[model samples]
Target: MRPELEPGHVAVVTGGARGIGLAVVEALGARGVGVLCVDHPDADTSAFVAACEAAGVAHAVASLDVRDRDAVRAGVATAADLGPVAYAVNCAGVDGLHPASGMTADEWRRVVQVDLDGVMFACQAEHDLLAGRGGSIVNIASMSGHVVNRGVTHAAYSAAKAGVIHLGRSLAVEWAPLGIRVNSVSPGYTMTAMTATNPPEVNAGFAAQTPMGRLAEVEEVAEPVVFLLGRRASFVTGTDLLVDGGFTAW
Candidate 1:
C-alpha cells in the first residue's frame, strides 16, 4: 500500500457495477487500495473483483440501493469488513429527461429520490466509516446542476444535482472540524453507458455546444473523482470539481 494509504485502508464506491462508477473502482483498485464495490443487488460483481485482484488489490462486493436508508447504512458496515473505509464516492444515480411542464409526479420524485436523496443517504452512512480515521468524500454530480441542456429535458435532474452540489458543500463545512473533507465532481456530458441511450443526433448536438467539442470519456471523469478522494486533494473541500468539457463555460 502507498504511504498515504495504510494496509487496511479501503474505498467504498457506489454504483460500482458499471459506467463511471465502475471506472472509479478500477482506478482506486489499481493503486492497491482496498475497495468495497456496492451496486444493485443483482449486479455482476465478479468481474469487478477480478479486475481489482489483477491489480494486486483487495476487493469486496455488496448489494445495495442508495435509495434505501437501511441498506445504505448497512452497506457501509459491510464494507468496513475489508478495512477502514477512508475514502468514499457517491456515484450511484439514474439518468432521464423530462420537461417540467409535462413531467409526471412519479418521474420527478424518482429522479430526485435517486440522484439527490441517495447522495444524502450515502453521505450519512459513510460518516461513521470516517469517524476515527478521517477521510474524503466525492459525490458525482452533473453539469445539469449548473446549466440546462439544449435538447434533453433535465429539469428534474438539474434540480436534484443542484441539491447534491449544495449538500456536499454544507457537509464539507460541517465535517471539516473532524478532519473529514467532502466535495462534489460535476461532469458535463460524459460518454458512458448512462448516456448511451440517447439518440445519436442528440449526442452530436451536445458535442456542438461543449467548448471541447466532444463529450467526456468515463475515464476522464473518473480520474478527477479519484483525485478528489486521494491525499492529493487533502485541502480541497466544499467545492465542485467540474469535469465538463467546458459545457458551462459559455
Candidate 2:
C-alpha cells in the first residue's frame, strides 16, 4: 500500500527545474508536500513555481549552484522559512564521458564537484533544520555506480556517484539516532533531459540490455524516491535503491 501524505511537510529538491528533478517535484507536490525547487540561475525556474501553484501546494524557487556552500546554505534557509524541511532530494549533477587516458583534470573535478561535493553541501546545509524533527534525504546516484557500463565511458561520473552512495550510508549512520534517514536512488537509463542528449541509437542499445527491455519513464524512478521520502520506507536507511529495469541483475 502507498503511504498517506501528511500535511505540514516540506520537501526541497535540487535540479528541480527539469527532467527527473521536475518529476520528483511533481510527485512530492501530488502528495501534498510543500516544495522548494532549486535550480541553476539560468534555468526556467518559474515553471516549477507555476506548477506548484497550479497544484495548490505551497512552493518556492531558489536559484542556486549546489557547488557553492554559501548558496546552498541560503537556499536551505529560504526553504526552512516555508516550513520544517521534512525531505531533501539532491538531484543536481553532471555527467562527463571521456576515455580515462585522455580525461582532463578539470573535467574530472567538474563532475566530482557537482555529483559528490554538491550532495554533501546540500545535506550539510539542511542538517540542522532536520535534526530535531527527523527528515528524509534521498540523493540521486546512478546504476553506473554499481556496475560497469562498457558502452559508455564516464569514469568521473561513475566515481562520483560511488562516492554519493557511501556518503549517504555514512550520513545515515550518523543521523539515524536523530530520526533522520539518509538513502539513495540509483536510476538506470531513464528518459530524461540528461539521457535525451545521447544519440537515439545509444539509448536503444541501453534499453536492449535491460531485462525490462525499455528505458524507464521519469515517473518510474520518481515513485521510488517518493517511497523513500515517505513513511512506507520508515525502516529503510543507509542503503541505495536501484530503479534500473534490472540492468544490474547480470
Candidate 3:
C-alpha cells in the first residue's frame, strides 16, 4: 500500500468500470483505500470487483447511473457502510460528436445531463458524506473544456465540460469552509475505448500535435487524482490540473 493512503479510508469513484475511472479506482485500491466503484447497470462491474480483489483491497460495487439523483444518493449512502468516503472522483461522462446545426435536443440534453448534472449529483452526495471528514473531490473535465476542437463538433460535450470546470471551482469555495476540497483534472486526447474507435489518422494527428508526441496513459492521469485525494494536496483546491501532454501548449 502507498504511504499516502492507509487502509480503512474509503473512496468512491464514478464510472469506475473502465478507462480512466477504472484506473483511478485501481490506484486508490492499491493505496489501501476501500473503494466503492459506481457505474451504470450495463458496465462490466464484475471486472472492476475482480481487479479490486486481486489487489487485496476491500471494495464494493454499485450499479448506478449518475444522472439519477436518487440512485446517486443511495449509492453514496451505501458506500458509507464500508467506511467514511475520504475521496470522491466524478468520472462518469459521455461525448457527442454531432455538428451544432444537426444535433438534436435529446442528444444535447443527454450529454449535458450526464457530464454536468451527473457531476453535481455525485459531488453533492459525496460532499454530504465527507462533511466532517474533510475529504476531497476530483472532477474529470477535459482539455476540450479549455480549448476548442476544430476536428470534432462536440459542442454539447464541450459546453458540459466547461460547466464541470466552473462547477468544481464554485464547489471548492463553497466547501472549503466545511473542510472539503474540490478540484478538477482536464485531459487531452487520451487513448480509451471511446478513442479507440476514432479514425486512426485522426488519433495519430492529435498525438503528432502534442509536444510529447504521444497520448497520456491512464495511469498518468490517475496519479494526479490520487495526489489530490491525499493529504499531499491539502492546500490545493478550486484548481484545474491539465494532463494533456502539452497538447494545449500550442
**Clashing pairs in model 3?**
none
- Ranking under lDDT, best-scoring first? 3, 2, 1
lDDT of 1 by residue, 1-250 (tens): 4554444578888888888888887788767788888788877787787778787777887788778989888877787788777899989899767778999999988999999999998899899889787999999998889888777777889999999999999999999998889999999988887778889988889899999999988899888987888777889999998898889989
What TM-score does structure 3 among the candidates reach? 0.97
Clashes of 1: 0
How far residue 87's Cα lies from its native spot in candidate 1, in Å, is 0.1
Inter-residue clash pairs, candidate 2: none
lDDT of every model, 2 decimals? 0.86, 0.89, 0.90
Full ranking by TM-score: 3, 2, 1
Higher-lDDT candidate of 2 and 3:
3
Our model 1 lands, by Cα RMSD against the true structure, at 1.7
Those runs of model 3 whose alpha carbons end farther than 4 Å from true positions after fitting are: none
- TM-score per candidate, chains pooled: 0.95, 0.96, 0.97
